[model samples]
Structure formats: structure tokens, C-alpha cells
Target: MWASILIASFGTYVEKLVGYLLPHHMLERESIRRMTGLLPVSMLAALVAVQTFAVDQTLAIDARLFGLGVAVVALLLRAPFLVVIIVAATSTAFVRWLGWLP
Candidate 1:
């Protein structure tokens, strides 16, 4: 488990290092450009979906979904990323504190 964790960390670092070391011209290839542009958003969306919906290897419907809804609304309104996070967290905490989510 420790070895796998280290390997994954090293692989992630290597991927970032390669992304940084690659030349702008190489990234200018149409397919590469499109991929590079979409990759971050795609990754973020996947991360968000997984975190918002999955808990203990099962699909969940809870305060997290409401929090993510707040985040999405903030994003759609052009709020800064920090504000989006703050709003999401605040709403989630409020709902949980109010005993509205289980």
C-alpha cells in the first residue's frame, strides 16, 4: 500500500513535470491543444461528481448535493472560486447543523 501510494505520487509529479517541460509549439497541435484545454475542466468535473455523489462506495443523496448545487450556482453567476467553495461549505454546514440532511 505504501509503495503504491509513493508510485502514484511520483507518477503525478512526473505528469506535471512533463506538462511543464513540454514546449508551447508541441502543444499547438490541434488535437493536443484541444485535449490540454479540456483536460482540467474534465478532471474537475469528474472529481466533483465523484465526491458529490459517492460515499462508502455507494451513491448518496445528502447535504453534499445541496452544497454542490450552491457551488454550481455560484460558478454560473461568475463568483470567484473561493466564494464558490465558501458558499458550498457554508450551505452544507448550515443544512447539517439544522438536521436537514442525514
Candidate 2:
């Protein structure tokens, strides 16, 4: 077991070292940077979509959608980050408390 852990840790360390040593020119390409910049946002959006719109093995839209919309509106209005999170969470909790979802 210790051997396995040592091997795994060594492999991970090597991979990170290679990434850290890679030539900057490779990452400096305009298209690469642009796409990389969007990757995080796209991934988070996908995660949120799955959680908000899926139920068990199927798809469903419910009160979570309302909370998400409200949160988005608050973000677009440049509300403080904490305010957006709190409003979204509170709205979701209130909806659940009211038994808006079955």
C-alpha cells in the first residue's frame, strides 16, 4: 500500500513539474488563452444546469429555477457578491419550506 501511494505521488509530482516547466510560448497563443479563459465559466455553467434541471435520472424544472433567475438578476445588477449568494440561498430555502417541490 505504501509503495502504491509513493508511486502515485511521484507520478502526480512529475506531471505537475512538467506542466510548470512547459514553455510559455505554448500557453501564450491568443486562441489558447481565450478558450482557456472561458473553460471555467463553461464548466461551472454545465454543473449548475445539471443540478438545477435534473431529478434522479430525468430532467425537471422547479423552484430552483426561480432562485437561479433571481440570483442571476442580482448579479447583472452588480449587487454585492455576498448579497447574490444570500438571496439565492434564501430563496431556495423558502421555496423548499413552502413545499413548492414534491
Candidate 3:
């Protein structure tokens, strides 16, 4: 376990070092700029999908989906970030409390 941790740490350091060593021109390219800008959004979407739909090793259809739907609607309506989060959490808790989903 220690060996694995050391290896991963060293690999991460090298990866970051290589990123720093990369030419500025490469980072400035239009395609690279676009990808970097969109990467976080895509990653967050993937994370949400996984978290909302997956339970343990299986797929789940439950209150989480309703919560996500509420979040999407809130986002479309231009709700503030904190409001969106609170609304989603409240909706999820309400659903769960109704004993409609486990």
C-alpha cells in the first residue's frame, strides 16, 4: 500500500511538472482553450449523473432523480446557486420522507 501511494504521488508530481514544462503556445491554442473551459462542466455533469442514478454497484430510480429534476428546473429559471442547492435538498428530503422511495 505504501509503495502504491508513493508511486501515485511521484506520478502526480511528474504529471504536474510536465504540465508546467509544456509550451505556452500549446496551451494558448483555440481548441485547447475551449476544451479547458468546458472540461469542468462536463466532469461535473458526469459526476451528477453517476451520483443521482447509481446506488452501490447498481442503477437506481429514486428520490435523487426528482432532486436532480428540481435542480435542473431551478437552473433553467435562473435560481441562485445556494437557493438551487437548498431547493434540491429539500425536494429530495421531502420525497424520501413520503416513503415513496428508498
Each model's lDDT comes to: 0.92, 0.88, 0.92
Model 3 TM-score is 0.70
CA lDDT of 12 in candidate 2?
A: 82
lDDT of 3 by residue, 1-102 (tens): 999999999998996797789877967799978998899999998999999999898998999899989999999999999999999999999999998876
How many residue pairs in model 3 have overlapping backbones? Answer: 0
- Would you list the clashing residue pairs of candidate 3? none
lDDT at 38, model 3: 100
Clashing pairs in 1: none
The estimated TM-scores of all candidates read: 0.70, 0.67, 0.70
Tens digit of per-residue lDDT, candidate 2, span 1-102:
999999999998986796689987877799988997899899999989998899988998888887898899999999999999899988988898999863
- Please state the error at residue 4 of candidate 3 in Å: 12
lDDT of 1: 0.92
lDDT of 1 by residue, 1-102 (tens): 999999999999997898689886866689977887899999998998999999979999999999999998999999998999999999999999999996
The RMSD of every model to the true structure, in order and in angstroms, is: 3.1, 4.8, 3.9
> Weakest 10 consecutive residues, lDDT, candidate 3?
18-27
lDDT of 1 at 85: 95
Question: How would you order the candidates by lDDT, starting with the best?
Answer: 1, 3, 2
